[model samples]
Target chain A: MAIFSLWVINKAGGLVYQRNFADGLAQLTSNEHLVLAGTLHGIHAITSRLSPIGASSGAQVIEGESFKMTIFLTATGTKFVLFTSLHETTTDSVLQRVYEAYADAVMKNPFHTPEMPIRSEGFDSRITALIGTGQS
Target chain B: MTIYSLYIFDRHCTCVYYQDWHRTKRPKPAVEGGILPAVSHAITPQPLPADSNAGSTFTSPRNTLTSTSGVVIAVNEPISPGPGLYQTPPSHQQTQANPPPSTSGLAFDEEAKLVYGVILSLRNMIKRISGRDEQFTNYRTSTYKLHLYETLSGYKFVMLSDPNTDSLRFVLRQIYNGPFLDFVVRNPLVIMDSKERGIDNEYFRANTDRLVKGLSVFP
Candidate 1:
């Protein structure tokens, strides 16, 4: 199984960070990438509003030809988007570990700015290490 | 989950049209002023030598005709050898003569040029390496996807959409065959030879917007 990429979106639908582990994907302009995050956030909000009573409003999986997207939302309104190959089945645990790492390495960092695009080296290294072990 | 914009470039690497729908931080148009010339210069196909044309069929209009995935493509015929669309600007040389300015303000246009350059380079590289003149359809990233449909005449239709958006090659072809060919290409008033300009007709814009909105999955 292959993991393609990852994205982090804030509550305002802005993309805070993005990383690609695989190649051959179409590259987007920085503005276009930001627009994509906003669009997804709007779609998620609309989906939540349309949800039936007693059901969760957040989107979970978006399946494609060769890959699948899994969205994990945090209590503080942060979103983690994981793009994994179709055969990858154990993603929940992976997402949970990533969330834990983000809380420890990003949120707790004194230099990290709130609601801005994440630029912390610690967060990157931690997430990279987590992804390495998860893939193995 | 949404479409941000659409850009159409001609065979000359001129961005003939650009439209934004859902983008927030719109970059200044002047920022893109250097991209067209840079890209045109980068991807100008090498001219064939005089001896290689032996026995080649001399077709009227000089355009090469081919079909891919049910879409008809017409390769653009070389118009002239002089300074028409193929000429690269001297500004590129001026930068060599004098020191270039800092790149902080040119980030957006730089990325745009890079994207176009990469696409053109990859297309030519793949054709040469694989020995197949296959047409590019679409490519996806983790968050978004880009769809491309090119006419034989070298007019390219490109759309940026959500990664999970179903294949829209047929839709792009339809737009090309239906509204684009009818309203823009064939219209006498619409000048196709202009540089750094888009098709500026209300009829084309209205109809195209309608066509795009009519799609079942567009949101």
Candidate 2:
């Protein structure tokens, strides 16, 4: 089980935070990450509206043969997105841990601004530590 | 605990078949046929006497849905008195060729086009992220999940069901292999991707309904 990458999108649909691991997958440029993140944001909103049921949530999982992307949307509209291997059994636990870390390291940080690119060193180390332990 | 609908898109990206069991507000008819949209309004006043046991207000509109859908449901009524497997006369099947009539009022051609667009963009995204060997199976919303099964022949079978249910891709595959192959693909009488017609027939609809009803999660 391995996590390939992580993306944090602000409520405004901007790519605020992005990171990559698992070197085997093809890498993307910063521009590509912004484009992909924006596209995903748009698609997520469209999917939520596509359903005939009440529109509380949108797409949660997009699975491929080798990897799967799990998206968690917070009540405030911020999205925590993760791309992991298909065999990753601890995704939910890992995501819960990451959310807890975000609440601590990012949200509580005085230097961190809302809806902007995340650049705090403490949050970076915390995410790295989370991903390190997340690998099984 | 409900299966909403199923749509089959042929190679040309045209919705060739559609069926829905529990859907509430009907989809507005596409602007393609100004007359058909008018017909939908005219038919809305009368309600179909359907079993309300599902605790859904959706079943009330089943009878006056559309001519093609109305016939398909009526053919399956207990009044027909046919065995589990029996022949339905060719006349009982919807055979309109020109104008490519939409079957059910629950979802129209316009909605099907949006369905195709969703999957198409999702599939394209999957391709961009992973190799060609990988494909997307399903995506979920708060209320429902959409399962997709793509055939080598370019047929796409999409089913929407309760979000709590497990993967329904296997069920979609079975439909493609069973009823779809038997009634549509294998039969020479039906054109595969004709723009002027849909591939829906009584045999396929009955078998699909039976298959969905047989599912453990169906409610």
Candidate 3:
């Protein structure tokens, strides 16, 4: 599975972390990333009302022609968004693995503050090791 | 499987015609009350399973009739053990708390606008990211799946169905080419893209309703 990029949004709709793996997507400015994250946050809230059922899971997967976005929302409102190639169907497992790495390496670190931009070295290495092995 | 609703938007992004089959919670303008707060202070809506059917209101299938003052309790929530008549006064306290609207249902116009906004922004985002000309056909949440069909003339027909069902964009297309064309585009009396008026008329609504209800997925 080819994961194009990843974004981690805090509960308040701020882009805490973002990284690109494969390079098929058109690049965006850093400011644009924040705009996109905030837009997604608002859109997620809106999409819930679109559900036919009274209770709903907001935008879970949004598919384009080239890539698809799978969003995983934690109970406390943190969002893990992954951009993957259209053929990659195992996004759920990848998101779970990433969440595991984040919980252990990032959350446990003393230097990392909650809801702030994550700059943990342990988490960085863990993600690279966990995901880097899949690529050439 | 159940088909919940269909919304048709014209080229100018106005909701031309709307119909619903089995949506329990509809858009309503809440005037005065603490309904919104009561809902938040108590139970939050968790996603129903993919197979959830029409009239299967929020929360558990066992206690479906247990709606209290516009709020629904979660499945694991303990019912009062004191007595059968003993009901908690959660509603009394919330209604006194700085009254937001008692019902948090969206207004009909606002709901239509929100639906259009979602598709418009999503379409734009898809174009910029993929840099491709292809339009998005379908997307799914845990509770429901939305199938979108766009005509060359820019009419968008969106249908919300059970998440377990397959893509039904073809159904939307059929509605567009059949009833929409016959009652709206072909009729000379109906004005095209009128700002204040909708394309919804007796003939269009009747035909569309028949077509939707006749589908194999309709319960």
lDDT of the candidates, in the order given: 0.57, 0.68, 0.70
Task: Name the best candidate (by DockQ).
Answer: 3
lDDT of 1 by residue, B28-84 (tens): 222213344322222222344322321121111111111211112233323232222
TM of each candidate vs. truth: 0.43, 0.74, 0.76
Error of 1 at A122 (Å): 32
lDDT of each residue in B48-161, candidate 3, tens digit only: 431232111111121221222112335345433222212435443333222332224454545667778888888877777666686876677888888888899888898988
> After aligning candidate 1 to the native by TM-score, how far in Å is the CA of B136 from where it should be?
2.2
Best by lDDT: 3
What is the per-residue lDDT of model 2 for residues B1-219, given as tens digits with 9 covering 90 to 100? 889878788788877776777766445433233112111232222223222211121111222223321112342343231122224344333322111222333325446666787788778777776646567788877778888899998889999888877788899989988888898788787776666567766777788889888988787
Q: What is candidate 2's DockQ? A: 0.18
CAPRI grade, predicted model 2: incorrect
2 or 3, greater by lDDT = 3
TM-score of chain B, per candidate?
Answer: 0.61, 0.65, 0.65
Which pairs of residues have clashing backbones in candidate 1? B16-B198, B73-B152, B74-B152, B74-B153, B75-B152
Q: Model 2: number of clashes?
A: 0
